[model samples]
Structures are given as structure tokens and as C-alpha cells.
Target chain A: MEVTTHSAADETQVWGGGNKPLNASYGKMMMWFFIVSDALTFSAFLVSYGFSRFKFIDSWPIADQVFTHFPFLHGVDAPMYYVALMTFILIFSSVTMVLAVDAGHHMQKAKVTFYMLLTIIGGAIFVGSQAWEWSNFIRGEYGAVETKGGQILQFVDAQTGKRASIRDFATSIASERTTHQSSNGIWYQDEKALTTVTLAEVKAGFEANPNLVIRTQQLNENDQKIDLSRAASLEKIEEAQLVVEGANLIRNEYGNRLFADFFFFITGFHGFHVFSGVVINVIIFFNVILGTYERRGHYEMVEKVGLYWHFVDLVWVFVFTFFYLV
Target chain B: MAADAHKLEIFRGLLKFKSNVQKIWGVLIFLSIVTTFEVALGIIRPEFLLQDFLSMKLLNWIFILLTIVKAYYIAWDFMHIRDERSGLKNAIVLPLIILIPYLAFILILEADYIFEVMRNGIVSWNF
Candidate 1:
């Protein structure tokens, strides 16, 4: 951008070496560019999620029924509350991050440190909440039977219209069923861990119970899952081939197996981002405490990292809307 | 590294905060309110919203639009994009503006077409 001589004509050019055309520091501008790219990456993941969701619009699991658990509120249908709280925590952390950046602008070292600490704590809490959510999803509340055609059949109490857990109804059968391991099975073959209850046990229990009805994955006019008649429930139970207890990449008690795959991939990716963001924030937090920024005559490092932290929160807003709210 | 003065107005200059810290908190309140509204709608799921609108539920459209609003405030205010010069802002936002919707539209439309084929064609998926 430098010209041979300092002249008015040369100075008129926006790219003249002495001035910033965008009026932002090189590092800050680069951070903004990085955020734009990362935003597109997240948009791709969410859009593909939408693609699969619409592809299986008729049979996709209802997010509410899947994520109804809240910490310390057992058996209560608290939907969207935990995710909403996570959203608030991340947003509040964003607020504190900005406050830290503003304090940095004013050269207030202690204030910056305090806000950074708050931001880190909030991020840690969010990540922990996500881990809990993952656990809840992996260890499903109500077990379901998977048909030979790969459709999930959930049981509901006809009297109350609430989900019925297999554990409550499945009769314990004294059998010698055991998980196949490498030592016990053929040298080259090993089976996955056995589910808590076998399919035969479930079928026998369903035959014994009169109040239980089978709920299909299909949604009705009011967006509720369709419950089959008692006779049809008996017939459907005959089609059961495997007992699905929770979600994994291959099987999900919730609904379509792809739902579990997308849930694990997208949210797991976002959780990883939050984890790294927290790590970066902690690194910067120590720098703030050590007066590194103070010695450098600027807190621009904190500002750049603040931009990234806020971007993570921004991505979560979309994830929350698409994954949970929608 | 020079600290520039921030533009304190939000909502197209309809609302203003006295200081940067105050603006941060104001945006926080606004975002929290929007999130609370979304969660409430999700839980209640009003009957009218269950109706299909342009092939998707109206409630979903509302959630997407409100999510965009939340994302805008978080990016513009919390990330200090609003304080940036017009050139910098455009440079950062223009590409996404042109690209994200294009990808969503193409993918979602194709997915719908696939759904149609699976429904109407000889192949039976719901066995």
C-alpha cells in the first residue's frame, strides 16, 4: 500500500499504508473474518438437520417428548426449561464478556478480571448442563421396542395417556442371557451389551397388561403420536425384534435412528466448541490477572477472544431454536 | 488497539443506553425476554400454531424468525459489530446474507421432493 513519495494523491487512496481502510486492527478484522466462516459452518449443520427433519417429517420424534427431563424434577414433564436456562446462561456470559471488553477499553484491570471470571463460570455451567442433557438422551426415560422394519413402538398407559416405562411392566424372567464378549463368543465376533429387558419379556408383559397401548411414531392432526388400538397393539408387539432402551448412533428408543445420529453429532460438536471456548477464556483470564495486557498497553487480546465467545453463544441461539424449540 | 467510541443506540435508534455497560445489560434483558417467549411458546404449543403454513408449522416459522433476531443482537451489540464502520460490517455480513438461505432453500426443497417420491412412488417406506 505504500507509495514511493508522500503526496496528497497517494494519501487519497484508502489502502494507503498509514491508515486502516476498515478502521479495525488487523487482529480484530481477522477475528471477524473467522467468525463469518464459522457462522457458515454452523449454518450448514443446522440446515442439514432441517433437511433430515423435513425428510422424515411424518415420523420424526417430537423434541418435547424426547427432552422432557430437568435436573431434580423426576417424572415431571418439564420441557424446554433446561435448554432455556442454558440459553440464558450463555447469553449472560456473553453480556459479561462484553462488559469485560468494555472494561478493557477503559483500562480497568480488576473489573476485566472479575467479568472474565464470571464468563468462564457461566461457560463451565453451560458445558456441564450439556453433558447432563447428553446423558439424559443416551439413557432414555421410557424404553421402546424396535420392529423388524426399524420402527419404534412406545407404550403408553391408556388410562392416563402418559408414557409407560418397560422397567415398570416387564416381568423378570429367569434366563441365562448374557452379553457376548470376545472371551466368550467366537474369536472374531462379539455382540453389543444386552438391553436391561429382553424383547420376549416385553412381549409377555404387554400380553399381561390390559391398560397399555402402543404409540407409533406417526403424528396425528394435533401433532400427537397416534396410539394404536389394544388389538393392534398386540399385533404390533408381535413384530418386535429388538428392545431399544436409549439412543446411540444406531438405535434410538425415541424414534428414527437418524434423529439420534443428528442429535449426537450436532450437539456434540457445539459442546466441543463451548469446551474449547472455556479453555481459551481461562487462558485469557490468567493473562488478565497477570497484567499481561496491561504490560502490552492494550487489552485487544481479550477483545478478540470476546468476539469468539459471543459467536459461540450466537451459534447456540440457532441450535436452541432448531434443535429444541422447532 | 485504540478504543473507539461505541454507538449506544439499538432498535434502529429507537432505544438508547447511557453507557456501554448499560447497553450490554439492556441487550441481555432483551435476549432473555426473547428466549423466555420462545420457551413458553414451545411448551404451550398453541393449537392455531399447529396449522401448516407454507408447508411448515407457523410456530416453527416464528421460532426461526425470533432466533434470527436474537442472533442479530448478539452479533451486532455483544460482538461490537454495530460499532464497526459500514464497510467492515458489510464485509462481515454480506457473504452470510447471500449464502445461508441459499443452502437452506436448496437442501430443504430437495428433501421435500424426496419425501414426495417416497410417499407416491411404488416404494413403500412405512412398513
Candidate 2:
């Protein structure tokens, strides 16, 4: 086909930015693009998490067992209650965000401001709850001993069938436990301070307390941890290598290091998304007050940001299922 | 976009004062109920659902399916995708629909293979 030299075709063409393909604005389409790519990124993280869990299918830490701490009530075993509340709040915030967008569509400025404010408050509360959760997970409730082979061995009372914490039964033993400093060791190579509670103290405590039994991380057919007999418990305590207190990148008192690693990376990544969503919402919130969308004759900007906010909530839905429930 | 209302009828009456706000409240209540149901099931872990069905337990499949339902409402109502033009909706959704299961199948298959290796091969199963 021969091209026209007059260039009159340019005037008649609908492809020159005038026509909105798919009837979506450029910004909305970009937001969807970001959502798809980001969704793929999260899928990778979760699937790899699935991979690790599958590898350790029998010994993987149960979500119900691990995330049992409740805020304010220290000793209560409120499994999934706090997370459930957080899920409700986050979903409600999504509702408020969409309400703001709906109000924006009707050019209702006051309504838009009100709903946007609610969304901001909801987001702040969710973020604060996550920080608290991380604190509890890091601080930990019951400490465990890491065996020489990198397996965690917890203590339990044979009679009570309740979890025995390190603080409860472990007796303190005076050993030449100097804080491993880089100065005394391999000049340039230094390690962090050794665990405050030494293995000797734990072993002595275990021997003295006849009721204390060793519980391996593996689960029995009934989904309960198997406890070693007194004889085996004493024998197992001899293999204790390190005393672990809480969760970190390298050590997790809960069980697997990979579990904590994925927990931090996936949740931390999601928290970052929520944080940025709040920041963006704030910017748009201010723009609404400045009559920016009003001047533009439409509140499409509010709608655009609302899409992102909802996407964040959608991601959390999956996170809640895989992380907390499954 | 304002010309079209939300597709999910349950959320159409979310606000008590009536009008379109009702839709918002309706949908919100629906989602919260679904979530509450999920949390309840998670806590209970009924013995019947624990029985093996096809390779996975019925409970896990239920959790995954319910989770997908929640995700749908968030996308359809909260994100206003239901109000969007068909072409745009397809553009955003079809790729994910095709990609997620494909990724799940492929990655999970590989993971199962790795699990087999750890169990039977030279590498010891537990640390």
C-alpha cells in the first residue's frame, strides 16, 4: 500500500492519543500494569515459601502454633484473633477508599474528604499492628535449644502437657562465658555476642527437673509434638549446641530459619506497599483539599489511587490465607 | 465510570441511609462475613475436612477457594473493576488468570521433586 503524501490521514486517525484504548485512562492502565508485575513478584515469594514448606513438610512450624500471641493479653493463647481483626480493618479501609472514589465521582468534596480520612486512619492502624506483631515474633515467648545438627529442640512438661519455657525451668550455671568479641578471636572476623543463656545451664536445668522432657520440632500424626522419655530427654540434651531466644534472619526459635526469612521478606514487602499506599493516599488527599481534581472537572485521580489501595488489600487477602490460615 | 454501578449486589446496600452507599455497606458486610467464616474454619480444623481428598486435604482446598472468593470481591467491587469496560478488565485479569495457575503448577511440581530428592537422595531429610 502506498502512503498518502498530503498527511490528511493524520487528522482522521483515531490512534493519535485521542482514543482511549480499552476505555481506560493512561494512569489507570499503568496502575494495573504495576499491579500485575507486583502480583507476579508476590507470587514468586509465596511459591518459594511453598517450596520450602514442602521440603520440610513434616517438620514445618504450624501457623496456629507459632502466631498465638495477642496484644495486651500476654499469656492468652489467642490464635489468629488479632490477625483476623487486622484483616477486617484492612478490608473496611478498602471499603472507605472506594467510598472516597465514589464520592469523588459525584463531585462531593466533603464526602470524599471524610472517606479518605477514614482510609488513612485504617491504614495507620494496620501498619501499627504489623509492627507489634514483628515485635512479639522477635522477642519470642518460649526459647529453644538448637542442636548440633541445626534442629530446634523445645522443652515440655511430661505431666502438664504444656510448653515449658527456658525461663521457667532452666537454672543458671556460672561458666567462663565471655562475650565472643572480635578482638579475642580471628582479628578481622568477629561474631555477635554469644547467647545470654548457655547450653550448660540449660542441660543442668533439664537434668535436675525430672518432669522436663525434650520435644522435637517434628509433629506426630495427631498434629502434636512428640515428647521424648526421661532417658532419651537426658541423652538429647547432650547434643544442645546453641541457645536461641527469638526470631532473626539467622536464628528463629520457632523452627526453620526459612520460615522466619520468608515471614520477614514477604510481610515486610507487603508492609512497605501499605506504607507507600498511605503516602500516596495522603498526597492525593491533599490534592483533593487543594481542589485539584475539582479544577480538572473530574475526580479520576481519586479513582486511580483507589485502584491501587484496593490492590494492596487484594494482596493482603492472599497473604492472610497463606501466612495465617494455611 | 460513574455511569456504571458495582456488580456485586451484596455490597450495593452497604450504607444504611439508602442510595448507592447501600451497595458499599452491603459488599463490606459480605466480605467481612466471608472473612469471619474463613477465620472460624481455620480455628476449628474439623476432622472430616482433614481426611485426604485427591492428594490435598479438603480443608486446605476450602481455604484456598474461599481466599480466591475474597480476592474477587476486592477486585470487582472495591477496585471498581466491575464498572470498567470489558476490554480493560480482560487486559488486567486474563494475564493473571493464565499466569498464576501455570506458575503454581510448574513451581509446585519442581518443589515436589526437590522434596523427593531430600527424602530419598544423598542429602539427608532433616537437619
lDDT minimum window of 10 residues, candidate 2 chain B: B10-19
Tens-digit per-residue lDDT, A49-112, candidate 1: 9899888888899898899988999999998899999999999999999999999999999999
A1-326: candidate 2 lDDT, tens digit per residue:
99756466766675455776577888888988999889988888888888888777767888987899887887888999999999998998999998998888789999999999999999999999999999999888889999877888988899998888887777887777677666887888767767667777788888999999988888787666677898988988888889998889998898888999999999999999999999999999999999998899999998888988898899899999999998
How many angstroms is residue A224 displaced in model 1 relative to the true structure, after the best TM-score fit? 1.3
- Would you list the C-alpha lDDT of every candidate in the order shown? 0.91, 0.85
* Candidate maximizing lDDT: 1
Error of 2 at B85 (Å): 1.7
Docking class of 1: high
TM-scores (chain A) of the candidates: 0.95, 0.92
Model 1: residues with Cα > 4 Å off, grouped in runs: A1-16, B1-4
